[model samples]
Target: MRERLFAAAERVLAREGAAGLTNRAVTEEAGLAKGLLYSHFADLDDFVAQLVLDRFEAIAAEVAGLPERAGSGEVRENLTGAALALLGTNGPAVAAAALSRSAVAERVRQAWEGGAPGPGAVEEAMARYVEAEQRLGRMAAEVDGAMLALAITGTVHHLRMHGSALPDDNPELVRRLVAALVTVP
Candidate 1:
């Protein structure tokens, strides 16, 4: 039921943008009783917050596996794959919904404050992966894993914010950035 609601919300968000999202719209899109939303969430803000959080959590989970892939592939390729997986999702729409609504933004802020992982989790995952590679002598010993993680995630966030307005060449750019960061002396 939660997946149904989330999918419905995603559809509404994708087709109508944040401004067009409403409990009624989500319910209708989900083809469920309106009361189901209220039963599952405290309000539209909560729903929106959960929607975005769910996506981030999935990304985080995927990233959490990066350390295991450390020496299995090219560092640049692996990092690029992770970055692209994040950007290829409905992240832009979820981000827009959270940012456009103050209540939603507050909910998200509260979640983050309450120990829910945000972009920081992704950065940390990337840092762990980089550290693993450095241990294997694949990355520069002098490189700061955390800093490189921040740069990659920051660029991903920037690209996601611009959405379709930006050209579709960001994957290559991210690849190059990762390559530069992992380059050994």
Candidate 2:
């Protein structure tokens, strides 16, 4: 039921904009009793906060494939693949939630500023790729993978925020940006 509620929230957010979000609407959409929401969450603010966190966990899961690459050209493919996936799904939601929910805004700030755990998905992916590149002597020893990760993630998030004019469901820009940012030099 709790999962249903969050799923409903995501559907509403994707379809009707964050301003249209409401507990009653979510419960109606979820086909669950109204009390289910209050039973699972203290209030809308708590639900929104959990939703924000859930989105990050979703992105992390989507990109979890990056770390398992073990063949030629795998590193670049993994990084770019993860970046594209990240932008395609959770990217827009994160941006929308930031504008619609203050808790999301605060969490995004903390995560972006390195206050969150483990330097985030982009950072973790970048670090893996950089280590691989360094092993192959494709990158300089001084390259800061964490900084590049932050930049790439920030760019993707910002682009998604203002990306209404772009081709719907196209992640070409995100792929290009991640490629450029993580390129060996």
Candidate 3:
């Protein structure tokens, strides 16, 4: 049910943008009763907050599996894949949500305070993958894993914020960025 609501929210966000993301719009998009949202969430802010967190959690799970790829794949390839995944299904929607006023932002802050992983989890996942590569001698000893992770995620975030206005070239751009950062040999 939550997944259904989240998908509905995504549709509404994509079609209506953040300003149009009312509970009515989400319920209409989901084909569910309007009351269903309040029953599951305290308000629209809570719903939006949960939607953003759910997306981040999904990305975090993907990142959490990066260590298993440590020695099996090229480090650059692995990192590029991870960077691409950061832009997941909800990237544009999440970026739109970020522009909303206090309600949604406050709920997100509260969720973070209550231990939701949030954006930092993506960076940490990339850092862990880099550390794994370093341990396997796939990355240079002098490379800063955390800094590299930040650069990748930060660039992805910037591109995501630009959203459909730009061509779909971010994946290749990220791939090249990762290749530049790692030593394949």
All candidates in order of lDDT, best leading = 1, 3, 2
Model 2: per-residue lDDT, tens digit, 1-185? 76788889888877777787888888989998877899988878778767766666666776655545534564556667766655666456545756677765675566656644222765577667666666667766677866766787677656656564654644777667766765555
| Residue 171 accuracy (lDDT) in model 2 | 75
Clashing pairs in 3: none
How many clashing pairs does model 2 include? 0
Model 3 C-alpha lDDT per residue in residues 1-185, reported as the tens digit of each score: 99998998888888788888888888889999988999999988888888887887788888878877889866778888888888875687666776585787777778777878766788888898888888988878788989999998887877766664553666777787777766655
lDDT of 1 by residue, 7-111 (tens): 998899889998988999999999999889999899888888998888777888777799889888777888888887676566787788889999888988888
Question: lDDT per model, in order?
Answer: 0.83, 0.67, 0.80
Candidate 1 structure, TM-score to reference: 0.90
**Which residue pairs collide in model 2, if any?**
none
User: Which residue window of length 10 is worst by lDDT in model 1?
Assistant: 161-170
Candidate 2 TM-score, true structure as reference = 0.78
